[model samples]
Target: MTDPFFLCTLLWFALSIAALARLRRRDRQAIQAQIRQVGQLADETNELILFLDYSAPGFKEIDAFLLTDMPGRVTVVFHAPQWLFAAKAKRWERHCVVSADCLNASSSGMTPTRVVLDKGGKYRVFYEVPAFLKLWSRSKM
Candidate 1:
């Protein structure tokens, strides 16, 4: 009786491991397929894109930037790099200001960017808000 019980337990354990391995492989394939689709969409739209792997070990969301969900795990895409800075500012409860010189330097990848917060006049700014709310408010009286 004891021998039979032990044999059954061992068999069950082995089967569980095998099933887990199969599920992992399937999940990986699904994630890969979704990533390919996202890449295609981004290319078609000609927009700057960023992909965040939430399922990956040691994964951390970027300090700023909004993520759009397509399925398995999560993929994040930003309209522009400047949006990232704006998002960060929003998170920090601060305002984001961009100057032509700083923007040019950062985007051009020609020189190191220096952070300057001085009392100045008008400058470019960016902010984040719920798209639905924005559209809804615009439509309302």
Candidate 2:
């Protein structure tokens, strides 16, 4: 009968819609679970140390940049605050430029200074007298 055919088509359409909805829901939940796992790991790490090259635009391809800027390579150790533990680490590097500069200057030694960076954009600079300072001073006299 025509009624049976119409009923079958309608049922098939309803089942397809339900299946698509279930797949979407599962996908969303899987994404959320991944996010939570990353957050947990970030919390445990406390701090992240990233070696960077100041000559380059950003922290892309560590080996290539290191080879090009071998003389000017720097190590950036980022300390994520407790509050920002849940925040992703990748975003911080992109948004923060001052931190990068501090790291660059510390390693380059063009300036005899060391910088300490903390959360909320706070930093301190300390002068590091070269190890041979006393000897050099004696030689000057």
**What is each predicted model's overall lDDT from 0 to 1?**
0.34, 0.35
lDDT of 1 by residue, 84-139 (tens): 54654354332222212221112222112111111132111112223322332345
lDDT of 2 at 94: 35
Write the residue-wise lDDT of candidate 2 on 1-141 in tens digits: 469989999999999999999976664454334323433433422111232233333324433322343232223333334333224234343322223222212232222222222233232232232222233234545
Off by over 4 Å in 2: 44-92, 95-141
* TM-score of every candidate: 0.34, 0.32
lDDT of 1: 0.34
The residue pairs that clash in candidate 1, if any, are none
lDDT of 2 at 47: 19
lDDT of 2: 0.35
- Candidate 1: deviation at residue 115, Å? 28
Query: Any runs in candidate 1 off by more than 4 Å, and if so which?
Result: 44-61, 65-141
